[model samples]
Target: FAALARLAAELPPALAVLVGFVDRERRGERTLLFNAVALVRGGVVEQVFHKRLLPTYDVFDEDRYFESGARPLVFDAGGVRFGVTICEDAWNDVDGPLRAHYDVDPVADCVTAGAQVLLNLAASPFTLKKRGLRPAMFAGIARKHARPVVCVNQVGGNDDLIFDGTSAVFGPDGSLWARAPSFQEQVLVVDLAPAQRVAEVPASDEAAALDALVLGTRDYAYKCGFRLAVIGLSGGVDSALVACIAARALGPERVLGVAMPTRYSSEHSRRDAQALAEALGIAYRVIDIDPVFQRHLDALGPSLDALGAPGATDVTWENVQARIRGTTVMAISNRFGHLLLTTGNKSEIAVGYCTLYGDMAGGLAVISDLPKTFVYKVAAEVNRQAGRFLIPENTLTKPPSAELRPNQLDA
Candidate 1:
């Protein structure tokens, strides 16, 4: 508040600033947090708007953490009665996805309170083509209120979350005045007093997903204080795709690929992983796990003999190979202070096809939310967007496998 007050003091009489921040309030021995936006002018905060429509579904938990604001906020600044809203406050479109969630529309409330302009500060997470729908909703709000609507969304990745900054402005006639690009960070200057209007371009589904993953991976690593990443390469599509994302996210020089080959590992798999490493110009290492596998089998052989099992069974040996590989990569990650990236797809995780503390041993699961089918598509997209095979053609075409046992296939 002090910093903003000082900044407001320095601003000219004709200018004002709108900023989003978390507000803390005490209510009868309980501390409450509210997602809020403030309008400032002439060294004083004119009005503060708390978010009303707290979304609680599909990755959102606002209702659990925040106290909803009781009323809308409208304040006079620079000859305009600007209305301030924080995120979900302006998302109550009649035909929108969250329309049924709330009865009162914040946009309508602002206009009813005599607001000339509408402003929404948001941190909306990216999902498929979710970016395309927001502008349409804002346009509707602008048309209904007869007020120019401006939306500023957050950009970059936090943990596994991706916020696409497609900030935009619309005229009272429901026409787009200006827009910032999706999945990128840039300062957008909007002139709502525009002469010409442009239509909103629909974002491509595959392209947007690729960009979101890359941004999420980059921001997640940087925020966690990791400049380097390591991935256990199986030369399958899943690992190959993750390597591509890591290389792009942290630069090829910061990514390391380790291939742990065992007795059941295929020769083509080794070559394909190496090919990808060379193509991306990342550090690569090959470790033979057969000797280690032999040691484990020897140590467990006597214990298994008591269980009436002669040799390694489906319940044990295949997992032994997986655990060996996981340990190898984890050691590399820990030794070099690298973030270990797991390559298991959502389908495997959903059905518990993943090994505990084995293939699942990593600092982050890069593709745990990606399905096996979508894995192939996004991997191909990595190559397609590059206009060349950064990931080898054979890697995408080959049958998916963990190579933990002979004649095994993930299909």
Candidate 2:
């Protein structure tokens, strides 16, 4: 609160601010944290609003750390009365298969309290489906209240969670007044006026998704203090897509593509990887792992025989290749101070098809949320937009494979 007060004191007089933060307060014998928002104007905090609805499901666990607020907070700003609500408060009236857990209607309370406008501050996570549903949810609340609703949402990737900052304003008639771009930061300044009809919002789901992934990748690397990225190019859709994303995020100059091939790796696969690196204009290198793999088998064969496992199973040998590639990439990342990018798609991640210490090793998982089918879709889109095969035609048309064994497909 003191820091926020100091910040507000430094800002220009006409620019009042609503700042969201965690506030600690005494609750009986315990100290509780509240998800709080404070309105600061003229170097003074005029009013404070606490989040009433705490989402406890899935990625959110606010109920464990925060005490729910009891009342709707209304304040006068620029001679207009406005009500403030946190993320889940405005989501109460959303019609969905997901069960509503809260009974209080914060938005309704604000409207009934004579609020002319409503403001919702949110840190909503980005999933493709959840993002698509947001505009309708905000519109519904606006239509119900017969007042303009403005929402400012946080954006960026935090670990596995991605926040697409598609902050927007909606008119009382369920019309969109203004919208900020998704997955990036921007200042949206709109002159307030009476509600009026507007055109339907443009449809760009796939493009928005691509932008989200690109922003998520870039933010994750920057937050972790990485300006350079390293990726193992396997000539598969997952790795191809990951390299493309990393290049887009960090730029071609900052990305390095290393292709590690063992004896089992196909010649065409190597060609595909090299071609992708060339197209992306990223630094490319090939490290042969056959000698290292052969040495491992020779050394471990005796130990396996003594344990009544005379020969390494197919899975074990396959893991050896993966671990070798993983080690190579990690060494490169360490030596060059580059962030390592893992190339596992959502489908493989769901079923644990990837080796934990091997292919799963990376500073970031660039396309881990995209399923296998979606990975291919994105790869094709990349080529289509480029007006040529940026990822190489063979990489797209060839059957998916780990290439750990001869004639082995990714079945």
Best by TM-score: 2
Candidate no. 1 TM-score: 0.93
Q: For model 1, how does the per-residue alpha-carbon lDDT over 103-138 read when each residue is reduced to its tens digit?
A: 878877888898899888899888764666677788
Please provide TM-scores, in order, for all candidate models, with all chains considered together: 0.93, 0.94
Residue 124, model 2: lDDT of 89
Worst 10 residues of 2 by lDDT: 194-203
Computed on alpha carbons, the lDDT of every model, listed in order, comes to 0.84, 0.85
Residue pairs with colliding backbones in model 2 are: none
Residue-wise C-alpha lDDT for candidate 2, range 103-182, written one tens digit per residue: 88888888888899999999988876766678778887888878899988998988777788888888888788888777
Cα lDDT for residue 153, model 2? Answer: 90
lDDT of candidate model 1 versus the reference: 0.84
